[model samples]
Target: MGKEFRNQLMKVQKQFPQIIKEVRGKGLLNAVELNSKALSPISAYDVCLKLKDRGILAKPTHDTIIRLTPPLSMSSEDLQEAPKALHALLEHDLPEMKKQKPETVSGTVPNVCDRCGRNLYG
Candidate 1:
C-alpha cells in the first residue's frame, strides 16, 4: 500500500512539480504535504476541504501536512479509487483551492466522507 501510494503521488509530483511535497508512511497510515508556493500560499485546511470534495478523507497535521488513514479493512477497490481521487485533486482542485479565502476553510472532521459515506468522526 505504501509503495503504491508513493509511486502514484510521486508520479503526480513529476507531472506537476512542487504541488505534492511527499507521500510517505508505514503501510496505510500515511501523510502528504503540499507546496503552497506552487500556487498562492494555501492553507492545509483548505486543501483538506478540497480533498474532501474529491472523495478523500484527509485531515491536516499542520499548515501543510495531511494525514491519511485508510481503514484496515479497506478493499482493493477503495485503495485504487483513493489515489485517483487524490490525483484529480492535485491536478484540478489545487488551483481552485488556491482561490478560496484561507479563513473560509476549516479542519473539522466531515460528517460523512464523500468516498465511502463513512462518518469521519465517531
Candidate 2:
C-alpha cells in the first residue's frame, strides 16, 4: 500500500506537471507542493479548503503545501480514493495552465505566502 500510494502521488505530480512542484513521501505518508508560480499559483489553503469540501482531511504545513497522512491501517480503497480527490482539486485549472507553459520541465511550486496569496518562495 505504501509503494502504491507513493506512486499515485508521483503520478499526480506528473498529471498536473505545471501545478505540482514536488511529490515526496516514505509511503502513503506524503507531502505535496502546489506550484504557486507556474501560472495559477494555487494556495495551499485553497487546496485544503477544496479538500475539506471533498471530505478529505489534510493540512497546509507551509505555504503552497499539503500533507497526506492518513492512518497506517487505512484500506486500499481509501488509498486509491485519495489521489483522485486531490486530482479533482486541481482539475479545473491545470489543463489551461499546462497549455500556457513553454518549458517541458513545466512550471509549478508553492508555499502559502502572505494572506494576499503570494508564493512564499518569491
Query: RMSDs, each prediction?
Result: 7.9, 6.6
Candidate 1 worst ten-residue window by lDDT: 101-110
Model 1 lDDT at residue 40: 46
- Candidate 2: lDDT over CA atoms? 0.74
User: Candidate 1, residues 77-101: lDDT per residue as tens digits?
Assistant: 6776667777787778776766664
* lDDT on C-alpha atoms for all candidate structures: 0.71, 0.74
Q: What is the lDDT of candidate 1?
A: 0.71
As a TM-score, model 2 comes out at 0.71
Cα deviation at 51, candidate 2, in Å, is 0.7
Candidate 1 stretches greater than 4 Å from native: 102-122
Candidate 1 TM-score versus the reference = 0.71
Please report the candidate that would top lDDT against the real structure: 2
